[model samples]
Target: MIYAVGDIHGYADQLDRALALIEADGGPDAEIVFLGDFVDRGPDSKGVLDRLVRGQAESRNWRFVLGNHDRMFLRFVTEGQQHDDRIKSGLSWMNPRLGGTTTLRSYGVGGPDSPAFQPPRGKVVETLVSWWTNQGNLSDQEVIIAAREAVPDAHLNFLATLPLWHETDDLLFVHAGIRPGIPLEEQEEDDLIWIRDGWLEDDRDHGKLVVHGHTALDTPEHHGNRVNLDGGAGYGNRLVPAAFDAGEVFTLWPEGRRPLVPA
Candidate 1:
């Protein structure tokens, strides 16, 4: 059996439980695929990622697809000051409003920054950092610089290596939905990781059954052509992990399985 888990969003406890549920449901040999956003907006982004890094080292069957937040996190850490608005944004990843503060806290970074500290509104991350410093929020600015150092080397490498999507004979697993009508192989990376635009509205088949997260729902949604398994875990609720037997879907747990539509 193949199992694909939805956005984990840094809740290590839920992640552990979800893994246990998968193990109980499919035993040791099941192929596990994780759709990302594995960091930000939760208590333990580092803890959640550390577990995945270890899982990858131990199991060749484990696969991961990067999410938008994960992309932002990577840019914040690795890309440094180089900013193109096309690929980078204005320190949104470091702002608490976008859940970056919670993610940084997981790594033992980001102290009590000034409540009033706001970077100059700009399109470049370099400008944001510079503005923070200019505003005399020196402590917050220094923490931003050092937080990248706080991330473990293994964790950084793991995040850097995550794929945009994973595909099987009949299913395309991605962090977010693919753009409708576009050839799957030719779809833009941004659309795969961040799209909600017309992709969510159009019901036209995109060749393969797209299984995804990013757009959260109260429950796993079966929209015929797609399955949305993001249970809003980042917003603090159950982490919805799912299993697919051939192409049928199920919500999995230790006690039992709830067959999701057409199963």
Candidate 2:
């Protein structure tokens, strides 16, 4: 059996519980597919990433899909690009609406709002940039440099290499839903990681059973068309790790496995 986990959103404690449930219930032969959004919003973004990285390395069963938040993290530390409109050149994912600030804090890099977020001037002024571009992307050198410096080289490397999707003969796993009516092979990157417009509204088939987590829901929903495992774990809700086999789906709750029905 293969287990598909929902969006973790930086809740490392919850992610651990969910994993414990999976290990106890699914056992030695089970493989895992993580639906992404493993960072941001909630507490312990670094912890969440650290755990997943270690888990994946120790066990060969783990698979991961890229989420938009994960992309933002990569952009700040790896690509040095701020794609959000709220972002200025060197803000380092400063916009809190997507919980970038929280994620930054977890890595020991305070947000722009924090007094220590950036120093007016110092040794670290330019030692950590993409090329050590002490030339902060922002007019304010101090603020732009901490986010990159605070994160470790290993974590940045891990974020830079996450896969966009994972597929099996019976199931297709991704961070977000797929575009309806379009073949999976031809779907665009934006649609795979960010599209929600017609992808969620349309009831048309997506060729394969796509298991995803991006659109948050209070409970995990199985729509027959697709399975949504996002339970808003970053927003004080449960972090779900679901088990899928044959044509059935079940969430690994504290009490044990419970059936998850189609939406």
Candidate 3:
């Protein structure tokens, strides 16, 4: 059987529970795929990555597709570009406007007790240096520390190496929605990562059971064409996972929520 999970934006405890459910149903033999957006906007981006890497290493059947957040992370590594800057200069302006400042504040920076709110130094540096180094590869302690010192350059290369998408006979996975009318190969990464209304509102098939999580919707909405599994887990919404196998489709929500059958 194959189990595909939705976006897990740094919710380690919730992810642990979901994995436990996966194992309880079937252990290492079960194929597991994570839909992506495994980091950011949560308290423990580092922990989420650590668990995923560890899980994949321990289980040969595990797979992870890159989410838009993951792509942004890769851009940091490959292009030596800031996440928002790579999206558009408009994103840079939108960051502060769209709760970036509030998110930073929630992290205990730039708030009442904030030590120094230095611009240009960037949140990516702060998050990587403080959180990421604490998680993976004890042998690479020195390397990670050195990378943190270099900031934009070293970090960018590390993120660029992640896989952007994955698929199986019954399911298609990505960080964001795909273009409704375009062939999958012809679809642009930007559209896959950033699109919302146009792709979701349209009623057309993209030739796969597209499973994604970037939209941050409150419920796991099915537009009858694709299933959006984001559920905004780290943003105080429920962490959700969708399982698919031949002749059976089920969903698991975090405690205190009800699961829904696909319409």
Q: Pick the candidate with the highest lDDT.
A: 1
Query: Against the hidden reference, what TM-scores do the models get?
Result: 0.87, 0.84, 0.71
- Residue-level lDDT of model 3, residues 196-239, one tens digit each, is 76776777767777877788888677655677888888576767
State, as a TM-score between 0 and 1, how close model 2 is to the true structure. 0.84
Better of 2 and 3 by lDDT: 2
> Candidate 2's residue-wise lDDT over 1-263, tens digit each?
79988889889899888888888997855688988888888879999989888877787688888888888887766655545432233334544556776787788655335222342374222122221113333332453467667788778777778888999988999988787877778887777887778878777677778899889999899888798899888789988889986789998877888898875
Number of the top candidate by TM-score?
1
The lDDT of model 3 is 0.59
Sorted by TM-score (best first), the order is 1, 2, 3
RMSD of each: 3.7, 6.4, 7.2
lDDT of each: 0.78, 0.76, 0.59
Backbone clash total for model 2 is 4
- Which stretches in model 2 have alpha-carbon errors above 4 Å? 85-92, 111-141
For residue 96, give model 2's deviation from the true position in Å: 1.7
Candidate 1: tens digits of C-alpha lDDT, residues 68-149: 8888787777765323243344545556656776787788765445123344555235333422323245454465567667
